[model samples]
Target: MKPILYVGNINYSSWSLRPYIALRWAGIDFDMVEVNLDQPGYGDYAIAEILAFNPAGKVPALRVGAAVIADSLAISEWASETGSSLYPQDPLARALVRSAVAEMHSGFAAVRRDLSMNIRRRCKAFGLPADTVRDIARLDALFAGHRKHAAEGPFLFGQRTVADAFFTPVATRFRTYGIELSADAQAYCDTLLADAAFLAWEQMVLAQPATGFSRANIDRLYT
Candidate 1:
């Protein structure tokens, strides 16, 4: 049976998008349950619905048979086990990929805080916090290094991997907020934006009405 993936709003759920993209890229068959994150009583309702399958009370949880896998990274790892092209074949390359993904999973608080993911909206550029600037520089460096080393393909590691999936939201954030990037970094972002799966997700996101969940502080960074 296909696994069930629980997701939140496509326009704002960055974590949920990771596994969804990974599974789609891997060509894995799966079902999805989209919880209305913008609805009234969403917190309680989402918690209740997710906890029934995953104790973590989070979206992006994958239910396979009787087992529930929580966390986006964990779900991606599980999906990789199904002969998915989520990881590189070389041990060293795989290690680097995992490192990039883990760093993205735990770090980048400043950028995430200042430039929240909102695919449905685009904003004008404005001065960013020092920390956010630093985060963007770091991301540019990461993308540059990967692009330099990749022998083929426009993706970070020569082919799409979990690392690319993890950073996909970052690309969207840069675009949405008009974050300045080095030419190479901008090229990478452009490639991701042009991806068929990413385009499909964007179409779905645009079709949904705005959830009225706006961050005033982040919004101020845009026009």
Candidate 2:
């Protein structure tokens, strides 16, 4: 049986986008079910539905037969085992990729909090918080270092890997918030935004009906 992936709103669920893009990039075929996270009664209905599969009651849960895989990184690893190009062959390179993916999975709280992923909305003249600025700088440095060692590809560590999938939402965040990036970082974001899979996701996000929920703090930052 083909795997089934449960996702949340494409406009705001960065975690959901991670595995969705990873599976697409890895050429893994799967069925996707979108849960309306912004809808009324989401906590009681959507959360309950997701909790049946994932104890954490989170989006981006993957179900393969009787086994359920929770978390984006876990799903990415599973895809790699199935001949997906989610990691490198060399031990050292694979380790580096894993490290990057792990950092993305756990770090960048300020960026995630301050600039929530809203693909459908673009804020104008939004000044980032000090912590978020620092996070963006770190991301620039990380992308630069990886680009230097990459093997003739636009993606980090050369070609599309799990690391790139993990950071894809960050790229969209940079665009939505009008955050400035260094040449290398901007190019990396450009490459991701230009990807067919990413574009398809964006199109899907745009097609979705608007959710009434809004982030007041983020909106306040706008001019």
Candidate 3:
């Protein structure tokens, strides 16, 4: 049976973007079902509807036959099919990728919360909270540390993996908030932002009606 990926707003959902990118790179064909988180009158009531499929009440849920999988990382794992690491070959590489993906999955709450993800908007970054600054610094350091693992390609693993997919939303957050990065890290972010799948997602976001959610106005609803 064909899988159905229920995604949230591409403009604001970093979690949704993660599994979608993983699915794209894995060349796993699936139908995308968008769950609009808010609407003219519904506000956040629309978000609660995801409980029908995802008990967690979050998006990026996947339906495979009779089984429903929630959690962005879980869905991404299914897409990659090499465990959470998504790199099927070398043990060391797989472990490193897993560590990185796991870090993205559960850590960096500061960057994830403060910067957030607003793919279609750009803003001057300033007044960053101390925790957020530290998060960005750690992210930059991770980018530098992980680059040596990639002996060839621009991606973290020499080829795109679920780790890179996990990082894509952070890259978008960096861009949207104008968060400065080290040159190498910025280049990595640039690569993610220019990825064809991501570009297509951005275009799709452009076509959708404005939800009136931006970092300038809405703080948490878009996330």
Candidate 4:
């Protein structure tokens, strides 16, 4: 059986996108099972099914044979350990990558609540709050720093690392929301948008037959 990941609608599940991006960056093969997250009782049975693999009852859980891994960061790390150098191999570089990933995981609550991942739709002024503004500024600063340090390639630390995976959704959010950014930041976003894996994953998300997503909302961001 192929390794499987249980996820919610790709149009809105930012957390799920993290690991999906990582797995793809690592070039690992996996399967996807989508749950209608907006539907009632979406998880009662889904939880049970996934708990047979991951007890957390969360979407974005990874099933690798009998080994169950839950949570995006954990799954990304697991993917790194299994096959690819998802994180930087050097100790110091690995530390920097992990720090960036942790910052991504722990911080940005404001940005998350303000700009929920709605890929199929867009919103204007975004109604973002003051706190979210502060957080966004901070994130931009962090990304700028990474870009300066990104000597090797377009990726955060010269190459694609777990840190890039951690922020992949944020990159998408920035694009979807029409958030204007600095040249460096915009360049990083371009790299992510240009990634074949990201594009493929996005195509998969957009192909879902769900309804209610508003293209108008999304267009306003770009306009």
Task: Give per-residue lDDT, candidate 4, residue 37.
Answer: 59
The clash tally of candidate 1 reads 0
Model 4 scores a TM of: 0.87
TM-score of 1: 0.91
Runs in model 4 deviating more than 4 A are: 41-53, 213-223
lDDT, each prediction: 0.83, 0.83, 0.81, 0.78
Q: Report clash pairs, candidate 1.
A: none
Q: What is the lDDT of residue 68 in candidate 2?
A: 88
* TM-scores of all predicted structures: 0.91, 0.91, 0.89, 0.87
Cα error, candidate 3, residue 98 (Å)? 0.4
Q: Please report, as a residue range, the 10-residue window in candidate 4 with the lowest summed lDDT.
A: 213-222
Candidate 4 scores a C-alpha RMSD against the true structure in Å of 3.6
Indicate the TM-score of model 3: 0.89
Residues 1-223 of candidate 3 have per-residue lDDT tens digits of: 7799998778888889998888888878889998776543233324456877877677879999899888888888888883334575888878888999999888999887688688877777777789989999999998877777556788877788888999999998888877788888988888888899888788899998767553234454323
Q: What is the model-wide C-alpha lDDT for candidate 4?
A: 0.78
Q: How does candidate 3 score on lDDT? A: 0.81
Q: Which residue pairs collide in model 2, if any?
A: none
Query: What would the per-residue lDDT of candidate 4 be over residues 112-143, giving only the tens digit for each residue?
Result: 86676776665455567799889888888888
Give the Cα error of residue 70 in candidate 3, in Å.
Answer: 0.4
Question: What total of clashing residue pairs does each candidate reach?
Answer: 0, 0, 0, 3
